[model samples]
Target: MRSGLLVSGRRGGSGRVVGMLHLRVVCPVDATDEVLAVLKAHPGVTHVALFPGAAIEPAGDVVAADLAREATDEVLSALCGLGIDHTGGVTLEQIDTALSDAADRAEEAAPGEAADAVVWEELLSRTGEESRLNATFLAFLTIACLLAAVGVVTNSPVTIVGAMVVGPEFGPLAAIAVGIVLRRWDLVRRAGLALAVGFPLAMLVTFGGAVLGSYSGLFDRTMVLSAHQVDFVFQVGPFSLIVALLAGAAGMLSMTSAKSAALVGVFISVTTVPAAGYAAIAAVLGEWAICGMSVLQLVVNLVGIVVAAAVVLALRNRRSRTRDLGRPLSNG
Candidate 1:
């Protein structure tokens, strides 16, 4: 098997973190030639090897390559398009340490920015994992809703912020956006189910908590009526939608970039958990008007966030496709 050019280097070592990707692919005998061609033609790729009939179970030849992270998405897309992912297999792992001058050169030769690269399979895998509806997910939702309930009754913005931090609702919301963009109805359905079940279940538990708090005189109709912060939860208007839209877009971008720190801001900015809390408390106090308004606010924010995230993801995918089209397969 022919290999890509590997420049000799004296800087070879081990146990050093580097910005690179190690891709192990299993290619059918028939497709090995085409797969090798693609790998060699791509300048970002280096240190390639081929082992004939190495992979079993799926039964294919094993091909491994070291590449710059910036070029990974394009190479993965190309491989998928060539049906290597179906007839064989493709796996990617980040190199924790690369002690090689050749690796450094490979990184420098790769065009494009690493931060801007979007690994479609990786993104989908991550979001899919987050969309699972399990006890852990329910527990987080319960705690967030309860915190929101306490915040609503005591008018404590601190408690509300804490609830936002604890909440995992955004996972499903983001999954929905990704689903819509990728046209994966199953993802959309699973994410939708998480929301549909999570919210109502949380509200039900919080409603029970509200009843107990009312009996203990910790919460009452007068307190809710007097709490100025409660007004924020009940008010549904243009500003509420605008904030959700902005937060949704930011949340998706954060996920794509893997900068989870930004997601905390997204959680706190949305009214979903708080609105549910307020509605439950209002219902307990027989304040139907407040409850109705709070539910409306919740609906508006959810719709706004989902719509905005979907739009952002769609646009991002479009731009990526356009860029890929304009870029040549070879660096030269």
Candidate 2:
């Protein structure tokens, strides 16, 4: 498989494959007709091609096509029901840029605008992996809190924003919402474990460093009391909940549409990491009231995001007739 860098050169100017998927299939020779029929039946799929006897391992025919992002789950469902996954293989890749009129028409032919389409399968897979309680997740969350700690002490908005971007908490938070929408209780439990264990652990680690720094004359109570921006991090109010709700909605939209920039904005918009950091820092300084407030802030943001994201996903689910999508597999 080519790395993402290698695919960058294929970005033609005429059309953007922003909301499309590239599907490659290896199947037994006899199944080529069935695969073609499935691809052709979808109004949102295009650029279908078949190469006979192209597989070296499975030693069968190869079928390739481009599909609208919205149609991905439906097509995959149809294909999977054919038992292609067991006898053959399938691969789906993001098409960053496709400079073809056929691609444009393909998007236009779909149920909704490419940008508004929700590829639930892709979203679930991506978020599910991220929601793992792994060392990498812990590392990013710790680093973010550590950065937030420094930002709180020094009163640096830039550092705070950097911490927000570095934080990986959004993954599990998003996974929780997605899981709820899909009624995937296992996903919810796993993601809940990640958040349940990841945050306090990161905060505990940050708290130790904060205490060590304080004893070494690196921090003081004055720093906590005088900082302006950290004030926002530690304060809980109606607007805090409001901003979180807005960010959560925007974040879900970005996830569904695969919008990178908007996702970044969601990262910066929430104060989860910063609140965790501030709470730890305040605790180290013996400001129990401030620490409690920061913890409350953290809770508000987390709950608001989860509730808001679940709503967005639930609505999208109601709008989609996922089970009835695509044509039934041919018996021939």
Scored by lDDT, the top model is 2
Note the Cα lDDT for every prediction shown. Answer: 0.84, 0.86
**lDDT digits (tens) for residues 105-197 of candidate 1:** 778888766556667787898889899899999999988989999998888888988888888988999999999999999999999999899
Residue 203, candidate 1: Cα error in Å is 0.7
| TM-score per candidate | 0.84, 0.90
lDDT string, candidate 2, 197-298, tens digits: 999999999999999999999979887688886688987899999999999998988888778689899999999999999999999999999899999999
